[model samples]
Target: MPLFVKDFSWEQTDKVVFITVPLKGVKASNVDIFSSEEYLKVSFPPYLFECFLYDTVEDTDSVAQVGNGTVVFKVLKKEPGKWPQLQSDVIDNKEAMKVKRTEAFAKAEEKLKEQSKLKAEQKRANEQYALKEIMKAEEEERNRIERVKQSERQKATEELEKWKEEQRLAAEKEKERLMEERRKEEAAEREARKEQEKILKRQTRGKKANIFEQNAEGAPKREVGKISVSFTHRQFPTPERESVKPKEEEWLKKQAEARRIVELEDENLSEEEKNPMWLRDKGNEFFKAGNLEAAINAYSHALRLNHTLHSCYSNRAACHLKMRNFFKCIEDCTRALELLVPPVPQNADSRVKCHVRKGTAFCQLEMYVEGLQDYEAALKIDPNNQQIKDDAEKIRHLIQTETVE
Candidate 1:
């Protein structure tokens, strides 16, 4: 049983009541205070104080200060008035006061629970709003990038059309120039041939009249001989048969059969089920539903269909991390990072996620040095991320502490 604190003094105004209680030698840290609409309690080890007020006071507006071997309360009154006495009607009844104290404690706990629930709801609402804003911003950014790409593509197409038109005009001009040059050459050749015929006619008129007349008659008597034509036979050189033909044919047949089986299996799947993107979306749904195994299976199927899908690897790595398969997490994160090649702005966030996930796996495996390197790499990609910076700082601190130990 605690000694009752009876030396406390209090004063009352029309709207407020001030109570001062001395610690008598107890430290301020050891004091505990509770207040309600009509009850007040101050407790320290070996000391206890209780008051059932004459009227209800505004507990929400009440304030208590503890320091310097004393506790003072500035309690607001519910109604502006002076009371007949500080204590309530049950001041001398110990059992009644005890019951009042218990009820007040229960009410305080209930109020605290209500406040906590309200705060949690508010926090969830705020987080949802923030997520919405982030998604909206990302969508707008993608739209802007697409519009810019469209504009650039249109400009390139126009430039290509212009280049083709220029080439066509140049080709036409070259054809016309070549044709004109050929016509000029042909006319020159005709004139040269006419000149040569005139020269021949002049020479023949002077000298060949007597000599060619007898020679033309004499040259007609010559014999015609027949010649036989024959073609050489052509044959293709065959390649050397290094292996047995029957066994090679059998191997080829087996390969074809295996290929047919694979095709048949693929044909059994629906178009949506066959799509890697669809499987990835399904995996995301499973992940949100907290079905890690289902999510991993979905991601694995998606990866099989499209091995280059970095998001699937990254998502599967997340599932592995949650399942505490740290080695698998590291492997998936590494594969995802490899697939996210060239490090463009579009894949920057994915790269950062992979690096951070791998870093987390490394840290979980107590490979702090490797984990720190990955975290630093992630920081380089997302320098403005305060959360990553804080995490890196924590890892560094942990490493230092471990080293010292």
Candidate 2:
């Protein structure tokens, strides 16, 4: 049904022409190719093709070569201009099919390239939009923080001004109080002078000679009330004291009743109220309430009264730990441990806690060896304590770490 090649390509240039044909599974010696101005032919095993050219050409200048499983033919054109068609005669609509398929493929490839470019552009646009949104959010956050900082600074400034005014008013009141005290003192001196004059007039009524005789005799003197003056910044609690609330008074009363059995003969001990144990309890309450300064004051007072009280030291150490006063915590814990010397079975828990507290402080201070030693001591005191065991293990691991950073 076919007299020409079914699988072949042909194109004509201004000065030359070309025809390509596949020769898969065929050797170069086994294939044959020939062409003319009006005719093209190819021969290989099991395949034969022959077709007529569109124009007449010189057949002598034609050449054929086979390489990479393809056979190529080059021929000189009879004229130096373009050719409208590859073949002079057509069969089975092959020419129309080839032209349509080539154009469709080229159009499809162009469309694909355009789609890829558009997708790339859209991706880049989305990325830019995301970056812009992130930057906007960050800028807004910075603005919000700046506004808050400004507000806080303004509030602080107003508070400082108010405190200064209060200080000024207090100073004025103190000056007025001192002036009133001076007036009262002058009035008292005047009253004393009037009494002395009345006494002298009574003596003069007796007799001028008798007054001089009584004065010379130096009569037994009667005791008069003495005036005492003292100055102090210390505040003593009374009914009119503003700092002493009713609840605090009640707590002091309760503490006093609790310590009623203890001897109150030690008059030198002084604190907020009552005994050293009461002060210790007060410090513990302050610690529970998160008042570090008040707790420290109460504990210091208790220690001043009785330096052997270990509970106050330990509790104060706990407060110091919360405040991140690492060295202070260690010092208090050490003192508590010292006061709990010769650890008995009943005091083992206290000793263990002190050691663990000191160890934790050491760890926070980056003293790994000291921390480990304290933890080990705690473990020795309470071998069954899992917490101490874990703490010691962790410290050992930390020490073994070449760099804690």
Candidate maximizing TM-score? 1
The residue ranges of model 2 lying beyond 4 angstroms of the native Cα positions read: 1-272, 403-405
- Backbone clash numbers for all candidates listed: 0, 6
Candidate 1, residue 105: how far the Cα is off, in Å:
1.2
lDDT of 1 by residue, 355-375 (tens): 999999878766788899999
Cα lDDT tens digits, model 2, 1-405, are 423356788777798888888875678788776554456667786777666666667766778788988888787887789988776544457886455445545655676798899999999999999999999999999999999867755665575478679999999999999999999999999999899878767755755444234334687434344577975543344434556566776887667654653544356655446567898988888888889989999998777667789988998898888876777899999999989978799999899888898999877766789889999999889999887788788889888884655
RMSD of 2: 18.3
- Give candidate 1's error at residue 359 in angstroms: 41
In the predicted model 1, the residue pairs found to clash are none
TM-scores for all candidates: the values are 0.45, 0.35
Native-referenced Cα lDDT, model 2: 0.77
Give the C-alpha lDDT of model 1.
Answer: 0.87
lDDT (Cα atoms) of all candidates against the true structure: 0.87, 0.77
